[model samples]
Target: MERISFCPTLAAPLNKSEVASSRNDKSQWKTKENRPCLMVVGNDSAAAGTLKEALGEWGYDVVAARNGWEALVLAGRRPVDGMLVDMDMPIMDGRTMLSELRWLGHQMPVLIMSNESDEQVHPQLLMEGAQGFVLKPPHFQSLQQTCRKGFAK
Candidate 1:
C-alpha cells in the first residue's frame, strides 16, 4: 500500500533543530486529554485522502484503512473515538465490519458512508449499531458535521 500524508507545505523552510523542536511540541500537544481519534475506512484512495484531509483540518487524529479487515486491526490496536466506514468495500463490507466490530466488543461510535441513496439503507445501518450515515462523495462541510455528530453520540 502507498503511504499517503496530508501535511501542508510550510511557507518557509525550518532548520533541522527547529523541525525537531516542532515535532516534539506536536507530540506533546497530541497527548492532551479529550482529543478525538478518527478511523476512516474506504476502498477508494482518493476518497479516503479527501476525508483524511478534512477530518485532520478539524483537529482529529485521523487513521485511514483501505478495507474493513485493516480497519478492524487498526481499531483493535488503538483507541479510536469514532469510525467512518464506506458501505461498499472489497474483502469485507461496512455492514459486516460493523457487526464484527460490535461482536469484538468495540463500542466506539460509527458512521456509515454510501453512494446508494440513504433512503434505502441508512435506517437499517443505524439499527445495526452505526450512529449515523453520510452520503458518499460527501461535501466537506457535511462530512465534517456528520463526523462531529457521530463523536457527540
Candidate 2:
C-alpha cells in the first residue's frame, strides 16, 4: 500500500467513474456504484489525510473537500457514486450536508466517519441517507473493512 498524493478538489470537472475506479482495480472492486464518483468531505486535515491515504492505497479516485458547503457545491455539478463524511465539521455539520444532497436528489452512498466515541451511528441521527458510519481512528484493519463494506453495500 502506498500513500498516494492527493490534490484537493479546488472545484474542477471530475469524472465520477474514473474517480471511483482509481481507488481499486475494477477487477478487485466490482461493486455497482453506477455513478462513478466518490466524495470525501472533512474539516480536519489530519482525518482527510488519513482517508486520502486509505483511498489512494485502495486505488480509488477521490475528490476531497474541506467542508460541507464545498462538498455540496462540488457534488451538485458532478454525480458522486459514494461519499465519506466527517460527523463534526466546520461550515455545516455532516447531517446538514447529507440532507442538502438528498434534497437535491443525489443518491450516492454516504459513509460517516466520526471521532465521537460516545455517540453511535443510528438511522435517526444520520438524516442524510448515509449508509455507513465508523468512529475515527478505528483499528486500521477495522477501518479498512468498514470502508470496503460500505462500498460493497
Candidate 3:
C-alpha cells in the first residue's frame, strides 16, 4: 500500500515494523494514569506519531486509530478525555464519526482537523459536536490550548 503523507512536519514515514509495533493491543498503552487520555484518529501514521509525541510532551497519554471505525471500537472499550481527528480518512470520515460518537453518548470533546478549505464545514462540524475545528499542519500551541479548553467542558 502507498503511504499517504498529510501532516507537513513528518521527518520520515514510519517503517512497517514501527507501524506494527505501534498497533500493539491497548493493554500496552497507559491510559489509567492521572494524565488525560486522548485519542488521535488519522490515516497517516507518521503524522499521528508526531502529534502523539507532541501530546505526550504536553502531559497526555495518547491512543491512536487509523480510521473512524477503529476509533469507535477503542472508544467503546475505553474512555478518552479528548480527541483530535483528521476529517478526511479512509473507511469512515470525521464528520460521520463525530455524529456517531454523539449518538452513542461519547460526549468527549473532539477537535476536527482537515486540510479542506470549505468555509461552510466549520459550522457544520460544530453542530455535529466537535468542540473545535483545526486546520491541517496545526500549531502545537494552539492545539494544546484547544485541547485544554475542550477538557474544561
Best of the candidates, TM-score:
3
Pairs in steric clash, model 1: none
Which scores greater on TM-score, model 1 or model 3?
3
Once fitted onto the true fold, the runs of candidate 3 whose alpha carbons sit more than 4 angstroms away are 1-33
lDDT (10s digit) by residue, model 2, range 19-70: 4444334344344543244678998787777777777677566788998878
Preferred candidate (TM-score higher): 2 or 3: 3
lDDT of 2 at 54: 74
Write the candidate numbers in order of decreasing lDDT. Answer: 3, 1, 2
Instruction: Report lDDT (Cα) of residue 66, candidate 1.
Output: 90
TM-score of 1: 0.76
Worst window of 10 by summed lDDT in candidate 3: 4-13
- Clashing residue pairs found in predicted model 3: none
| Each candidate's clash count | 0, 11, 0
Give the distance in Å from residue 22's predicted Cα in candidate 3 to where it truly belongs: 23
What is the TM-score ranking, best to worst?
3, 1, 2
